[model samples]
Target chain A: MQHKQTVIDIRNLSYSYVNEETSNRVSVLHDVSFSVSECEFVSIVGPSGCGKSTILKLIAKLLDNNHRNIGIDRSKMSFVFQDFALFPWLNVRENIGFGLKMKSLDKKSLDIVVNEKILEVGLSGSEHKYPHELSGGMKQRVGIARALAMSPSILLMDEPFSSLDMLTAEKLRIDLLNIWTKYKMTVVMVTHLIDEAVEMSDRVIVFGPRPTIVKKVCEISLPRPRDKRSKEYFDLCDLISKEIL
Target chain B: MSRIILGFHLTKKRKHIFTTSFVLISIAVIFSYIIIISGDNAGQLINSLMLSLFRLVSAYAISLVVATIVAIFISNSRFGDMMIPIFDLLQNIPSFALIPLFIYWFGYTNIMTIIFAATSILWPILFYVLHSLKTVRRELDDAAKIFGAVGIKRVLYFLMPVAFPSLVTGSIVGFSIGWEAIIGVEIIGLASGIGQFLNTPVGNNNNQILGISALLIIVFLINRLIWMPLLRKSQLYAA
Candidate 1:
């Protein structure tokens, strides 16, 4: 395998929240560390409240990191939120072009990029629809397209498909993989589903329960469009499930 | 099935439009009748109504701007955290109680009337916007930051839209309170306005009835023409 340049690096990253009622520091991520290479698909799998999402937030700098040893160019990053986060007031095209608009891009260029993303995400006919009008699957597609419109080098997904129905999630997982292949950007996803982690990632990093640390980093070397029914696929899922549990 | 539903919606919309037009025409007829019957006093009444309308509008505009700025400030900083309780206390003080203090400062002036009304109007808008901003979904806030919505861009593209529906609701509430404040101030101190017109001792009960009827008509029109449309549009902001 060719060595890809490292795009994200975290060493001894820890975070705590001050409990509003108690005013006591409640630790979330304790000495958690991981790294991702350029063009790699990585998933962090763990039990509920294991700080998997916190790690993603730390990378995106959405939450204050307090100068932790986290390395990633935030300007080159885009996040796909769990709840889609499509601005309710913005139509599909406007939502996708939100990042570009924030950058003060010219209208001509903005329209071009937005139009292209709309097509790329299979939302070609729904450009004028609002978020409330979109189905959960379609909304997430808009979410993904919105992130892609930024032309990001790294994509961070915080349970991007967790809110979708089973069929929608399955279809989106494949669509996401296709988009990922096309873009060739680094992806770091946090998901609780072991099968999803195994099905999509080049590597899966499992975390322990709250105040989390990296429990294991299992490399998935299975070929493209890995057979989900195959024993090997189940074994890998089983392996990750064991590590997280 | 879709076409049937669409047809039903269209029929309902037409019925609504018809009803609105009928009400508007009725009000117009009533206004014309009032003007004809109250001949000499008609001009004075119209002028007073216009003046009161202007005062209410000015106060509303000022309140909207101030409330938005204050709400954003309170929602965004630690200073805002401390100020919220103080603002809550201030809002609780009956706005009418502050009229004497306002009169002492500005003394029966238009400025005093507008300012007094603005104080009454500001609280609902400020609290509504502040609550909306404070309660924004965590993921949406993250998405905004992650996608380069910071500084003024964040406020414009993210926060403002997030606060928009609540802002409309607040404005509607604020405008109603403002009407009371403006009228109360006018009736108590000001020399001219609809409130003064209404309060003026008249030759007959007809003039007083006309004044009250005109006020009601204007309020109804404003609600239908402005606030109702805005309230409908604001629903798009809901997630």
Candidate 2:
């Protein structure tokens, strides 16, 4: 996948939040350089609060103008937050269509896309239900639907599956991989789970400590639908562990 | 003991049907006496009912509008922090203390009375709405942001519905306060209205207060009879 046309181009990006009423600065990321090729699936693993979320926030452009030191080109990016972040007031149908509505996609096409997605995600019957009426898994499904509906070229996710139980997380990882293959969209996800990155992603990048930098980028050569109990699975996890702790 | 149980059952069954055997008999006795020594009976009845409804609608409409705007501002902005101190200072000033100022400003017009009543009562409603909007889930806000809402306009579309129950509760409390204020304000300065009509019977020999009491009953009954069911239905989907 060398020189495969990178969708994201990070160049010595560093970020720090201001200390209010003072000149002090809190550094989150530093000299963080990485890129994803078209249709590549990459996962970022880091210790908690090590600027993993800050990277996604920058990509979403939900950062302050003063935080430009933590540089990002927020446009041309779509983010999936750690919390499911579903609008409780909106029904599943409206929530899924919300992004397309914002970007002003044509009404007729938007409806068609929303309908197609509702069925594709196995959420066809519960279209009219609000967020509170759904289970945690269902809420996350809606979140995924919302992000994918944007059809963004680069998708950024921040620990999207941290809330679910082991079984649900395992199943969603497979579903996510299938979705990734189908859409051929570049994805960069953050997680603390090494097994998840090994099972779902094509490449793994690790970030650590304040003033975070990319520690390693290991290519995952596993075949599709990779099972965790297999020998290769344990080896990849071990390799990631060695780099992490 | 059996008779007491029977009367309790009657009271329960006739909640709005007005069975109350003893009260109805007392009313009948008063009416018989009124007929024997009456002065313009029908005129007073009509006047009291009309005044109450007029004042109630006017004061409530004003309170609803003002309370909603204030609530939105308080909940959606950092300025909302100032609300508590402002309200506490205003509450301590006493509800009727501003009556003289109102009369001087508006010169005994209907608007004067409505304004006075609304000012005295809108705080509870505004606070309720602010509280409701503030308590909406953080996740809902993040969802709204991901959809590209950047500023004040987002509160209208994303936040208003999420705080529906609190809006209703706050509005109702405000309306009730407005209703009470209207009667008192009218009693003090206004020459026409239900409060004036009720006062006339107090000064004379008639059961005119019954009509005014009936109007009060209607306010509470109407709220439960009309809005409660709607609220319950909306809550089903909101959750």
Candidate 3:
């Protein structure tokens, strides 16, 4: 097998939040390090409040990096938020084209790109609907479409489907995996669901409770079209779940 | 079927236009009758009212610009932490109390009246926008930055739209207070305006009633025509 080049590298990344009232530092991630290879789908799994999302933020530089040794092309990254943070005032088309517009893409190309993304995400015929008018599933589709509109080299998702119902989440998970396969872009997701981590990602990076550090990096060697009922799938899920528990 | 739907829309639109025209014509007839009945005082009342309207509008415009700039400047900054309390303290000081100082400086001039009115109008808008910007959701802010909305782009695309609904509400509150401030300053110090017109010794009760009625009409028209439409439109900005 050919060795894929590392697209994202982080070494000894530490982060803390300062409590305003007491001026005390609360540690979130301590000496956490992981690297993602090109076109790899990786999920960071941990217990609640275990700083899994913080790791994504640190990678995206949404929070201050504080001179930490993190490496990635910031401009080549796009984020899909957990809450589907589509601009409320803008409709689906405008929401998807947001990053493209920010890049000052001309109207013709912007429309073309936006239209293609809308279709790809199965949001056809809802082009003019606002975020408030969308269901949780549809909203996440918009969020994913928005991220894809950037044609990013790396997609960072922070609990993209956690807000949806299980059925919607399941459908969306499959759709997202299809998109990941089609685009062949590196995707780093923060999710709490062990089965989801096993079902979708090429590798699962399990995190311990705060201050979070890497507990395990389990490679999912399951072949394409993975069956959730298969013993191998269940065993992989249990193996990853045990690290968090 | 499309033609029928279009025809229905046309009929609804026609009915709206007809109702609006009828109301406007009725107002014009009543206004003309008042002018004729009031005789020469009509011209004086009209002039004073126009002056007061101009002063109020100028003050409101200035307040809107200044409030937006100030709120955007201090929001999410440590400086905001210090200055917000100071601003709160300043807003609490009776706006009318500052009229004496304005009068001493500008000497009952239009500039003084406008400046005085602006003091009253600025606080509500500034505080409202500040609160809106400060309370924006963390994920939205992150998404904005992640999507390359930084610096002026952030202000124009992200911050401004986020603050829009609050800005409209603040402007409505600010405009109401502005009317009071403009009228009070005019009544206290200025030589001309509807406030001065009302304050002047009239020959009879009828003219005083006419002046008050005109003021009420102008205020009502402004609220109905401008602020109401804007308030309705601002609903679109709500997240």
Count backbone overlaps in model 1. Answer: 0
Cα lDDT for residue A174, model 3?
Answer: 93
Q: CA shift at B121, candidate 3, in angstroms?
A: 0.6
Score each candidate by Cα lDDT. Answer: 0.91, 0.75, 0.90
In candidate 2, position B139 carries an lDDT of: 55
When only the first chain is scored, the TM-scores of the models are 0.98, 0.91, 0.98
Selected candidate, larger TM-score, 1 vs 3: 1
Per residue, candidate 1 scores C-alpha lDDT tens digits across B143-173 of 8887788898888889999999989999999
Expressed as tens digits, the lDDT of each residue in B1-239 for candidate 3 is 99999999999999978977887787778788878887888998899899999999999999999999999999956788799989999999999989889998989799999999999999999999999999999999998998999888889999999999889999989988998898888888855898888886777546578888888778777887788788877787785
TM-score of each: 0.96, 0.82, 0.95
How far out, in Å, is residue A169 in model 2?
1.9
lDDT of 2: 0.75
| Model 2 clash tally, residue pairs | 3
Q: Kindly list the per-residue Cα lDDT of model 2 for residues A32-149, writing each as its tens digit.
A: 8887787899999987789887777666666653444433344556667677887666789988998887777899999998988787676888999988889877878888888888
Instruction: Determine which window of 10 residues in candidate 2 chain B has minimal summed lDDT.
Output: B30-39
TM-score of 3: 0.95
What lDDT, from 0 to 1, does candidate 1 have?
0.91
Q: For residues A1-245, could you state the per-residue lDDT of candidate 3 as single tens digits?
A: 99999999999988899989999999999998889999999999999999998889888988886755798887789999999988998999999999998999999999999999999999999999988899999999999999999999899999998999999999999999999999899999999888888889999999999898999999999997799999999999888888889
Give the top-scoring candidate (DockQ): 3
